[model samples]
Target: MEKLNESMAWLAKQDGSLIVGHGPFVESSEPPADGTSFYVQDFALQDAKPWKTPSTVERTTIREMTMRFQNAASISCGWLPLDAAPFSVVFQEVMSSIHSGIFEKTVPVVTETGMADQPAGFAIMAAMTRQPLPLHSYGWIDGDSGFSGATPELLFALDGTCLETMALAGTARSDDREVFAVDEKEIREHEYVAQTLVSKLLDLGNIDRSAREILDLGSIVHFLTHIRLDLQSPRTPDELIRKLHPTPALGPLPRTAETLSLLFEWRNRLGCPKQFGAPFGLLDEGKFDAIVAIRGIWWEKNQVLLPAGCGVIEASRLVNEWRELRLKREAVKRFMLPL
Candidate 1:
């Protein structure tokens, strides 16, 4: 708490440039009366390391994983990400590959309603998901910095050595950003997070199924839940974060193996466009933090680049998903709206 508070205090004193598009802010005075325009910007770090390597999975291994632990989990996810993602130095290389572009895609969707907002990028890890505020971050350039992001995801983060987390949700600044819901199908979809996490926990030891879902914080409303485990037995917080990382907010839907696997290796990927190419951040430990590279625009002086995408589920309607993702492109629309 002290560490985070101190950081916030220091940020307020800076010029607040390190954060421009999608980072956190201590307190915002008031958005421009002309209203804010939305655009995606993929900012990369000056120098960085790699993300974690994924576990290699084969058909037999996958089946074994399902057979041994599927039924024993109290909070299992339906997603099964293959253990073959870039890990360690490999991921750092992935992050370092920012010059060519951060593999970013931003779409601009302008609707006739709402204040014209943009959620930037969408991440789906297994279950725990959030439409992260693109403007939530901490840093400094020269002697100035501050946070952005309307609905800041981390409601309470005590970064005193061990990181404790609390999230918030379900408020709309305007219709530019779309919120999430956990309907029956969504619960089923989010099972991916639960599944992945539970498997890792089971590997540690006994964790009674005593946890339940609860709201992390409140304003509008979002389906929230909490998972509890005393990893002190033989496991550690480091282990938990390692195995259960790529939180739903930054990856894919819950209950799946990976959120943005090969995120760069999908079909029809070029369908959308890149708003900004450097939306990247480095974490305390060499991993990449989720950046709102989605809802941004790249304009060195007058050139514009936009990134936007939609959630694709088996139940996802192609046209409807397209429309929804379009609505998310409001980050730039904020600039083009009044026109």
Candidate 2:
């Protein structure tokens, strides 16, 4: 534990430029479909599941030489490690330990929500440490669904005066069954997200709000609402990023506090990994960008890796939650799986 604290302290000291980050990937099944650009490799599991049809999925491995954050992305920090699940302990611990909010946790629901639990192949971090990452985050109960990618559609580069803080709020399913919009309240959660994101983005930038507009991302068929803002100043990447994190996709609604409490309050009990999953994919960002990191797996060591699920809210149906997790897992499968 002391070693973990020491590393966290060393990382907090700023030396490299602070920036936004995100992470991991899906299982080694369902290879990437056409149209998507970001696909990952679960190469570690190449030989393990050769005989299987590929629908197979599992948890992560333990202790390995990981260099994710300042390096690449890994699953070291997820729920598979200490078995504590980041319950209440993760949240408070992050505040004191990592100086981070957006507390994350792993929970065992009343029903089987299909999110990855144990782990599978390895996806370890193999880089060296750098500097503390800049961060800004928010969370809201998604009365509707789970995102395909962690903040799926990423938006970077300068766009006039406005900083484009946007994501694809991808599809949701557990075991391949839809979970999000069951009715009015459910669908409303996603709508709340569209507006909440714009508000959050504006809060971080020094720009005029009234001048904002809804722009097209890529495939119009994708069910997502994009919002762009004009920053009043050149937001040092750190500041801009800090302002755009933990959007409604993570919290703010009723269950948010309870959900958040799970991380900080019960964190110790869960006993998951240390910084390995802390900022899973928040390092090495471009100019003001936010990567959702929804569907992913942590590469721990040569044969150890872990996958996790995001618990939405009570409104989130138990069975539906299971399907959402499956979809998320499948998202990562694209690059990992093969013909």
Candidate 3:
């Protein structure tokens, strides 16, 4: 592995290629008409210039990218146990809202913090790049502060008139796969996401929804339903992102301005990173692929933050939700281990 000592951004595509952008990057509202650009935005979509023009761009295989990352030194990092009281409060509020008909489901986040012995960007990036298939590696780094992860959730991939996306929800340990598949609460949660996505894209064009299935990732698993659409007309990347982002998988069931504002409040109270669950995508010419920013680590110097969210419905229990959060965080930590 070669040592890397510069600011950069990258996304692993489904086609077995990695698009890397070396920065000092410039921000733009519109993508360059005939080249590659990275799309980054906070959860709130506040940035007007979400398109980043890298100083230079390269297309390479993930294997090649992995070789370029210098092996990060072994360093001790201690994490603080997340307090459950706050999450418990949020859970109760979410349940009340569901019962009152304001929301059928909502996802609330919990963040865990740690202090590392040294800067952790290289270590995190190296691990993410080495992740195996089904987990697309992605990240943005600028010196001491950045976030990186290998996420399983694809927001969408638009290539010409065809678009591909998925509804990924319902989590369980691999050991509980049998029971989880039959669990009513888990099925309902997954259905909420899959069905909502169908409704959102119905007017676009021909739609195909795959049979629900399980996606196994060693220790963790999730219910996955693939959805594809053939658009009646061309659509801009920004328009599509706005229409489908924050699906019930990660946002309120009946997404509304009011509900979104409330969800943001809960996220802020729990110290969730602004970019968590946001859409991170790449624009190559006219093609675009975006992934949900989850299962990742954020850092500022030696301070590290890990955030995970669980969908809460009336049938959800506080203890189970808290356990799910920890499970998600642990899965991310496993990425830091040597491949």
Candidate 4:
């Protein structure tokens, strides 16, 4: 690998190994017949050629990569606090739709912007590589612009005839874990996501849905339910991704075209990054592992964006949802700091 200044992509696997693609990457509409290919797509799944064949690929541990990363100069950026008025408007619209039976749940994002003195790609990449286990570190950097983060939500992992995914929702501060575990409103929000995911995969194969549990990530906690399936037959990566991309966790509960359009309009109005909440993955041979592209930083030159989303249900309170968004953003900020 050359350095963070060049184009590169990476996805960490469940086995504690990181697959890194050293660029210049070649764009492809189909997965490579051999070797590893990094998959990158926008939240709307608009990219037609989402596969990128790296000039070089390497498998390494996070610790090894962290040591090789050169520490860049301290990044100095002034961040603006996100205004709550806009989010409140979107919240009202979402609640109205829910009451009208158009949607059971929907996630709306709030983005905080900042201006850096210089490009921050190297620093952000280095920080993400330092994140500990249970959180998968992923990134794609091209020149002075890119995104990187350590995310806890896995979209899915396919190995031969088996597939693994999880429903990660219902966020709360780590201190409030005990109360959050039994909170009725939070539980309902989580169940909406878990049940929707199961319904989608029921026809695919023999399914195993684990009991809902709490995932504690230092400053924050979320409800987590692991789901597995033994497919009756093989399925293509693209097919599986399209079927599961915007799960209720990151998309509308009743995922219809009209509902998704409304959600996209709200997201655009809020200035959400196109790639946030999208599927970021790596296809190595026949296996694939993808993670939800949340809890990350996106930048172009000196401009930086930190976006966080809160799932809105009929029972969601504006004040509580606002607080939850901030909690999520703060957790991402922690990734930029030394552990």
Candidate 5:
């Protein structure tokens, strides 16, 4: 607590580039990657941006990160009225796509807009401390446009010749453990996520992973499987990230035009301001790690938007899927929203 408070105190004072370790896109002029020797600028594969592999990185330490936090100018958070109609429309599209055989699995992210009376520092602290999951709190403030959130899904991480990733799907309220544990719809959805990722990984390396298990993260639970990739040859973290990003968890499987159309509809009708799983990358020591920036907050001007998502399949119900999306937001709300 003392360490966190001190970090916050330091953060309230300074300005310029702010990159909080192990979180989504913060302000760092250099390419976004983890550690020295190797760094990747666009790990999230944002549109046409190409991957950058620089020889060196301006190493970010805990003290350096603390200094970056000090750089943010003081500001109050606020909210705006959210139109919930788009979610209904997007939900309908998801069902339509699944039934038409365009997608076996699709994920749609919904945003809840509002304001925060507190400082960005407090929000970051609350998220890191309150969430019991592998949740990592992240934030960035540049002029008036900034975003922050607690993310539990790791896109992929590279440590030497071994690569690590997970297929996270099928979310439910934490208390209803059995529902998530045994529900057929949830189970099939979870399997699709894992199977799709495994097939993608097989093209790049040899796979060694355990069976899926329930990974309970306080307010929410998900079907998760920790994956390890033993490279058949050798591949950079950058190489593996490109192949694995926007997994079925955030977009669609098979990477087909029909499946991607759902995402376009989401952005056009549902008001998804940016890509869901694209936000954060970290290069620490010699190891590199990056996460899908889901289940977090996006801040611009005085407005704050909290976002959450769920995988939709043929068997998914409208009411249950909507409830699952809300529950994912509730997990984030525990920290971002005032008690």
Candidate 6:
């Protein structure tokens, strides 16, 4: 733990250099992008059309990138939206989508409190050390753009021909695990996520998923299902990512054209940046470990971005969701403030 803290401090102190460190592992990029190009191996570009299958740009291994970052002098941050979201407009859109039957279960998350003049790196380091999560805590700094947070969801982890993942949904602010585990609304929402992922895994291998259980993350509780897949043969990590992204936990069901249209419309209404999942990906070698970038602060220059999202179903209430978002944000906010 102490070594991890030391490594985080070393990465954080590197000004103008690109670095990403999670747990005992850290990766870095040289100097910085030419101030225009943002080099990210895990995430896609913002302008990527949702309908089109985006092409992947090959990236160097972490070992190579770390060497480059060490040799480079100055770091430059990448381009991301600095605009604030209009929550009211987004809330209305969620209601519209449910009424229009455009979505059965979709996540319409918003970024609140934009462009604050603060450096959240130390805060992130402190929070990560104090509250280590199973999904791992990651922080990245690119000349100008970067984000840090401990995720609760592991998109997928590959070991040889075996793969492990989870369906994490159904948020509750209660401390009592029993209450959260048995809530009907939460159970239904969790089932949507788990079932969706399980079906997709069938294309690659035989799979098994545990029944829903409570995942206690200090202040919050969620319904979680563990999934294990035994692939017929080894497959590339990228292939699995393409197959599993935008799950019902993150997007709407029936992954179709009509639903995607509604998803983007809601994003535009909420001013939700494409960077919601930014800085969220994995460490790939023989093993591929990745997490969903849900809770965290994305920072660049003097601007600080807090991104949060929630799933909306037919039973969702606007006011209740609004309050839920507040609670979600507060979970991270506690560690972000001065201790």
Q: Candidate 3: where are CA atoms >4 Å away?
A: 1-6, 67-72
Root mean square deviation (Cα) for candidate 3:
1.3
What candidate 2 gets wrong by more than 4 Å, as runs, is 1-161, 167-170, 173-186, 203-222, 251-261, 264-288
lDDT of 6 by residue, 214-286 (tens): 8777778888899998999888655776678777888788677788677777666665656565334433233
On lDDT, the stronger of 4 and 5 is 4
lDDT agreement with native, every candidate: 0.28, 0.31, 0.90, 0.90, 0.62, 0.59
- lDDT for 111 in candidate 5 is 76
What global local distance difference test value does model 1 have?
0.28
Q: Could you tell me how far off, in angstroms, the CA of residue 72 lies in candidate 1 after the best superposition?
A: 56
> Which digits, one per residue and each the tens of the lDDT, describe model 3 over residues 154-209?
99999999999999999999999999999999999999999999999999999999
Instruction: Select the stronger candidate by lDDT from 2 and 3.
Output: 3
- Model 4 TM-score, all chains together: 0.97
Over the full model, what C-alpha lDDT does candidate 3 score relative to the true structure?
Answer: 0.90
TM-score of the candidate numbered 1? 0.38
The TM-score values for the models, in the order shown, are 0.38, 0.44, 0.97, 0.97, 0.77, 0.73
Model 6 alpha-carbon drift over 4 Å, by segment: 1-85, 114-118, 337-339
lDDT of 5 by residue, 1-339 (tens): 222222111111011222333222223334455543222222235444322233323333334444444433334455465566778788887788778878887778777777666535444444433333366544433335555565778888777777888988888888899866988988898888888888988876779878889988877788998888887777765567667767888878667766676576675456565645673555545666666777666655446777777788888877787788778876766654433
Worst 10 residues of 6 by lDDT: 9-18
